[model samples]
Target chain A: MMDYKYIEQLLERYWQCETTLEEEQILRSFFHQGDVPEHLRQYNDIFNYESEAKSEHLSEDFKQKMIDLVEEDTAVEAKTITLSQRFAPLMKAAAIVAMALTIGNVAERAMRENSASEVAGAPVIADTYTRTEDVKATIKVIDQNQSAIMAKADSVKTMDLIDEQPEIIE
Target chain B: MKEISFKNDILPLGDLLFRLALRIVGGNRPEAEDIVQDTLIRLWENKEQLADINNIQSYAMTICRNLALDHKEKFENQNISLCETDHDRADDHDSPDKALIKKQQYETAEQIINQLPEKQRTLVQLRDIEGKNYQEMADITGLTLADVKVTLFRARQTLKEKLSRLAQ
Candidate 1:
């Protein structure tokens, strides 16, 4: 008692392109059995054709050939990649060198400016907090200058006085 | 959408792709072979984006289909014979009577299918033969869901009517 009615309905659904993949596969499996009922025999070829077609494939060597071909492309691409790789290290070194030189020059200029300022402002920096010996040396130099000027004034005053006394005697 | 490596995942699809190319270009195995190889190479070229695709099988199938049709168009433009049915290839393993019947069926099925426009022909091959679902069909053929159904329905109807006519 084969289920002819179910097969018929499935066939109808199949022709309408409405069958699920499992249902369709079932149809194929059913047709694959050697003794498809008379009405289904004609449809057997159609279902079997799909399986036969699926078995068709390219040659075994094709994969290797394709790999070779794709690798050839990769070789060309790798060449360009290597070219970029080669320049990368050089560019990096140049950038590092430039950075080092800039930092070194800036540091040297700062050091030079500090030394120059130390030389230029050495007296001012010392005088702001002069030691007692430094003050005594400055006071001594000032007293010497004052004494010389006083001595010259005394000589001039004496000359004037002598002239006045002579007039009185006359 | 699992991870798809080009060598691990995509390169193995060559045979599947070859079948699709053979179907689209009407059984020119050599051209289909070249097209399949070219499609694989193209996949390799675009391997960077292979993982981004939701389905690598359908993606490769689609590329194989387009390249096959492109080659078919160029083949047609050259005014060469586009019909190259390889029925003899099926004869090697079948029993004599069975092989005869298969060859006849194959030739008839091919004749009926080749009469169709490329889309419907490919739709039939993808659906009935490949057993691909509607969405995969849509993805491979670049057709909308409704259009895939309509086209596949039409192809099925045409096959039914034609096969029945041959029976009668």
Candidate 2:
């Protein structure tokens, strides 16, 4: 016959909240051993129920389901970028380069036309001014020649009149 | 701080949390399962702060307890009594009458426990069923150590008195 006096004392302490966890565990072990006095049998159900309830567990299916749910959550949180999205910065750079080239071509053409018009009109204005100056110089030279000829002709007529007036005076 | 894997560290706590939830929700298994799922997901969502906690199991228990209580409040009227389906296992050595008597004793003890108030019931579950010390119980329950002892004493006394009556 085994002694249960210690178990009884432990049970008394257990109800008073004075038993250590180990001591309570000892009581549990004792009650689960299947041979108890008639007086101690009433307490068997409590310990047995406690021990059996620990067997109440969530199934493996529950575990796998939870893992799937969590993994799905992680998948949703981290979305994968497509190839196009990955090259978005490069695409933006290419578009900007294309736009800049188009603008440069248009601006260069506008500048070329402006300079070409200036070059085409510049010589015409210079030639017109040069021709006006030439005409003025030609007119001045003709005026000087006509004045010298008139002076010379007047001198010769005075000489002829001197010679005829001498003969009339005799 | 050690790195905590959700698979290794947190997932394994599902059974413990489920048991606690089952007790808090008054043996509503489906609701208990839901509460545990919510608790685990919540813990995983807050995994960043888990490394800072001293005891992750106690922290998880606290979260499970709070969520179970919230669920219990929402569906208070629909709670099934505890141990309603807890039939005793048959022993080959025992006679049929002995097995029936054992079953009745279990059912009676369960009914007596179920009649306890929610706080006392939870204390009993945490201490006797879970084998948590007073400090762990205090931590899980957010009660002071003295308060835990007092509450557990009252709960154990109630169980003892009711169990003695059943013996009579």
Candidate 3:
């Protein structure tokens, strides 16, 4: 049998929480050998519980259950993922097509509006000053600015034509 | 840092974490089993968070404890009685050492140990049973080192007094 004196002293220290981990291990190992005299037998259960409590585990099917549950969880999540993934490319392509059509329509309308504005402005300029005397009279009033007036009108019409094209496309 | 292999690193912690969940729920095996499953799944979902953790075992232990406690709280709210699952699980896998034990003593031993406060019981289980050091215990239980020592001290004291009384 082991020395009762040392074991008693160790048990006292253990209650006080003064024993180091090694001393506690020694106490556990000592009791584990089942060599205790009468006085120390009471402490056996406490030590034994420490070792035996570990065996209170889940069943063998636990790991497999977890694996199945995890797989199922991921399966549910994958559906939303595939839905989003499936839409992603189609949405992107649609956006690209929509954007291209918008630009093409705007450009086509702009070119048409630009040509129409030029045609209208050419006729208006021609209609504005038919005679040189009328031109001189308007020039005197407008300070020899017939050509300048036509130039300003042409530039303003061009800008207005460019601005209106996108509106017409929509 | 090396990559944490799920099979090698994470799965290996299951038994330890299971022991912890079992400890927290006072040996309720099924609930403990659920908590372990939830912890594993949660950890897997948030595996990205693992790379930042210094001690994976401690982190896993914390998750198990918290989830077990949450289950414990729900059970209390529902006023459900803790069943014989604790006894059944342990008895399901009786060891040779256990056979040497008197039936009443083995039964009373775990029940008495389980009766301690959650923190104290877990500390004792992790330290004495699992052979974890004080630092790891502190990390796993989210207690300061001094608090771990104090809780463990009280736990041991409680076990000694109760076991002596039971021995009669």
Candidate 4:
């Protein structure tokens, strides 16, 4: 004889939303039998519905397709790490250095320009024409030196860098 | 406190995930399976957290459901498999004649269920099919306890109405 008290307790927990997965499984199992009690017949349809719904299964071919997709994803993931693993540190360090150098150069130039402009204004405002000429001369020299470095670098053969890329057929 | 292995421990959750996904996507098996695959991979990646999780099935169900919803949103117009036929149970019933009649009733129920809005359908699936507790259903669907119960009540009410109509 089925335990009426246990079934009642399960029904209570079921309504209260306190049944565990195992307990829920037991309920389904009990309800699944061919011979359900007459008093509990009202719940048979609900339990049977649950049982029929739980029988939902993916087809074999669909399952295999999932496995294949998962395998492909893992393969792609492996390749991604393999490619990035070699260059990831270099990329990080290069990014850090590039950012640092760009910030430093911009700050340094801004400070120098600010100082020079201040110097130009201060001497002119102080009515010191001679000192203003000296400041102008110093700024000109710095500009000339910068241009000299640029001209030297410009004179280096562009073809030499292009050839280093190994795309030249000849 | 069980040690979880990825292939043995985690992969098995794929079936449960698929079931949840199928429910969410309204029986779109292909999309459901894809969601399960995605959920499994995520769980495998986050296996470290599984040990700390109070309910792995609920956690996995949430992942699977979310993934399936995202996919359904993305492919809103894509032709999906008519999933009601996937578990047709054509030859399993003891009496073919009764089974045929029951099949008609089952199809009618499926049609009514398929017509439900996504939230109601999923709520019904979680409540009536999966037999989830309110707390677990709330956890899986990311709904509050009251919201889960309310939605489930409305869903069951709708189904009961439809079933009654069918009876009539």
Best by TM-score: 2
Q: Please list the C-alpha lDDT of all candidates, in the order they appear.
A: 0.79, 0.83, 0.77, 0.72
- The DockQ-based order of candidates, best leading, equals 2, 1, 3, 4
What DockQ, between 0 and 1, does each candidate earn?
0.54, 0.60, 0.48, 0.16
Off by more than 4 A, model 1: A81-170, B1-6, B77-94
lDDT of 3 by residue, A41-153 (tens): 88887886676667655566887777677667767874446777879999999999999999999999998889878876677676665676676765575643545556666
Residue pairs with backbone overlap in model 4: none
Interface C-alpha RMSD after superposing true interface residues, each candidate, one decimal: 1.7, 1.4, 1.7, 3.8
Docking class of 3: acceptable
User: For model 3, what is the alpha-carbon lDDT of residue A8?
Assistant: 86
In candidate 1, which residue pairs clash?
A: none
Taking the tens digit of each residue's C-alpha lDDT, what string does model 2 give over B1-168?
Answer: 777677998999999999888877777778888999999999999988999998999999999999988998898987755554646454446798987877776666666776788778888888888889889999999999999889888989988887788789
Residue-level lDDT for A164 in candidate 3: 37
Q: lDDT (0-100) at residue A109 of candidate 3?
A: 95
Best by lDDT: 2
CAPRI quality band, candidate 1: medium
Q: Candidate 2: where is the Cα deviation over 4 Å?
A: A78-170, B1-3, B80-105
Checking candidate 3 for backbone clashes, the offending pairs are none
Q: What fnat does each of the candidate structures reach?
A: 0.64, 0.82, 0.71, 0.27
Give per-residue lDDT, candidate 1, residue B26: 73
Residue-by-residue lDDT tens digits, candidate 4, A1-170: 76688987886676555566678677878877747777665555555657776766756776566567666766777543576888999999999999999999999999988987887668666778777887888777777766655665589845554333222222
> So what's the TM-score on candidate 3?
0.67
Instruction: State residue B148's C-alpha deviation in candidate 4, in Å.
Output: 1.2
